[model samples]
Target chain A: MNFLSRLFGKKNIMTDITIIGTGNMARGLAARAIAGGNSVQILAHGDKAKADALAAEFTGQVSTGVLGDAVTGSIVIPAVYFDAAKEIVARYGDGLDGKVYVDITNPVDFSTFEGLSVPAGSSAAEELQKATGAKVVKAFNTTFAATLGEGQVAGQKLDVLVAGDDEAAVAAVAAFASAAGLTPIVVGPLRRARQLEQTGFLNILLSANEQLPQFQWNSALSFVPAA
Target chain B: MNFLSRLFGKKNIMTDITIIGTGNMARGLAARAIAGGNSVQILAHGDKAKADALAAEFTGQVSTGVLGDAVTGSIVIPAVYFDAAKEIVARYGDGLDGKVYVDITNPVDFSTFEGLSVPAGSSAAEELQKATGAKVVKAFNTTFAATLGEGQVAGQKLDVLVAGDDEAAVAAVAAFASAAGLTPIVVGPLRRARQLEQTGFLNILLSANEQLPQFQWNSALSFVPAA
Candidate 1:
């Protein structure tokens, strides 16, 4: 079936997953969603021209628009940095209520990578959820945009850590990852976003280290539980 | 040569690695040291009897003493929790000067697992270093005691992340890990211990989740950088 048909496929697949922002992460998530056989709607935070340019690069059922333009997807993934994601959430207001929002922000202080930008004992996902009162699931924050686009790291399948209070929303995000052929580990409740963010920030710190050339921006965190 | 000979081998191996506290972590680290062909000196926080019992369980040159005893090893690894490590550091005072102190405490708020016991912008290792001008190397905090004792995780060589500001101290810890057949990734300076502690705490949270039975106390964090 075509991307359009698969998006609303025989199983009554949900609406197009709306993506806000036109950047590396946005492009990467869009590619993953399409790879999972779901249509994608890309909404640029600003400058529709960039969104249009990014969408044009992809094949199948994909659409693009400016941020304030209506969000068409049942699941919304703001694949931007922490501050931009917050701004998008603020602009959307109650519009994002009930929407399956996915937060993939590290919120680390880029200048020093010493600490997270979000308040202590809290995470970007938690703060954004509190701001919009949306069903926010923290996923893909640990995966590099390049790895997400490539769908693997060092010849191994990538594991996406998912955390959210809403069960169905968590399952939905898990399913999205599964459909894309990535293993989804449901870490725990939304509070786990704090750990997930820290983990991501840790990877960021390692990536920034010039001494360790192997741990480039693409280092992936893998945890293997006992069989 | 025997463990004692290896401790001061013909190459001038070095002093026995001193491990403080008689907990599972102490046993794990001591076992690792013996596995690396080095003698071990364990100092119990309060009960020398407990330290004696634990030392008696080992197969090689191992000694036991109370907390106030002179630390024999140039490298000291406190396997106690965060607070006890601090108390031990305080008691040791300038004695720990120039020592390669290994901090394994996660500093997690076990009461809720919602936050860390260490203050913002600091880690358990960083705090302990400030307490005693000891050259602290943050290592083994990411590995479970059981897995460390076993020397491998799920049939794979465990990747021990080593972070510290001291070059020789970091190399000492890395050599210790390497002698035990584990891969040591020198992440960065000691400040990066903040991330290492968070990584360990995240593992704890996952281990506590009933839904994830596989991620029991034995769950291991393994990261493979690009070749």
Candidate 2:
């Protein structure tokens, strides 16, 4: 056992999370990961300066690298758009084997925001899973970037709707969510990602809607338990 | 405008709603409409006895009739499945020109439960709107029949998400929802029904999942305001 583990009596282990992309989602996730006491790595696509800037905001063991470099974490989160997320997985290839891949892409067709870009009966997470052998978990797609930045909407903690075919992988993600001060609701298998993506699209549509003034980008999707 | 209106004043004006089908959803909606002080008519397709039985359960101004009979209400709610809802709309034709149509169909392929049965970029509400020139509003699809029976789940009022292209039609449905003691969240136009149906399908998928013990059929989807 390591000295830290022996001294603490409990396993003093820190989860290592690699976040791909340096966008708003990437920064939100990195903030949560750092707050959860996990080590985070920022990977920038073509722009190393962006990753470095994001990493500089954190004090913990945060690292920066360019895409295609060797991923150093067991749980890799792709916070990029749908197409980029797929490309990242394809480019990583066998490197993601056995690793828990967190997919936060909404897969919405921005051109119209009317429908999903994914093919019928498939989701971005499922597509990522098909591209690589990683344990892909669909999460954070339903949450807005602004909500994730604050980790809560209004006074309620954000509900992270997670879906994955692998139970252990889902539990790992759930643990990460709980540690990050978010509520994790594991809806179902990876196939449920299709629904999650749809709901996420709906949430985004509501946020963009001018009619619903109260539903800003800071709004969230939550499943309230019956009283 | 009429003798009834003169007798009861503005407060005495109760909306007359014609609900097609005598199924669980039909009964549940009828119960709510009655409790909300609205006159409800039950329309049965090829089965008058079922509609009669449902109408008999309510002491309020509830009536029963055949499907093709003249719908005697400003708001006509099709509580049947997607296919049947379409058929009803097609049969009604121009008779539904100015009336408000409430579409409660989910249009989910229950056999697979993987996706919606509606065509790409279309929804059951949208298809129904195309069939007739009636003002179509999408609501009550997300609320389960049992939950609708009580009009609230776990002490929290059920959120009836209303989506329609007609502002007046949406307002009428919203008024009905408020009278029924439920919160009405008008998402957007009829096109937004696409997302509502997707979220309904997702809710069903979660309810059917044996792995998610907490996601019982009684669970309600709510957008809790941040404190």
Against the true structure, whose DockQ is highest?
Answer: 1
RMSD of 1: 3.9
| Alpha carbon lDDT of each predicted model | 0.84, 0.85
RMSD of each: 3.9, 4.9
Clashing pairs for predicted structure model 1, backbone only? none
State the fraction of real interface contacts model 2 keeps. Answer: 0.58
Task: Give the per-residue lDDT of model 1 (tens digit) for A71-118.
Answer: 778899998889998998999898888989999999988776678888
Model 1 over residues B1-227: C-alpha lDDT tens digits?
Answer: 34655566423434569999888889889989989987778889889999999988889778777898878788899898888888988888998898899988899887877878888888888888888888999999889998888888778788898999999999999999999788898988888888888888888877887888788788678775654
lDDT for B176 (candidate 1) = 94
Model 1 scores a C-alpha lDDT of: 0.84
Q: lDDT winner among the candidates?
A: 2
Single-chain TM-score of chain A, each candidate: 0.91, 0.92
Off by over 4 Å in 1: A1-14, B1-14, B46-49
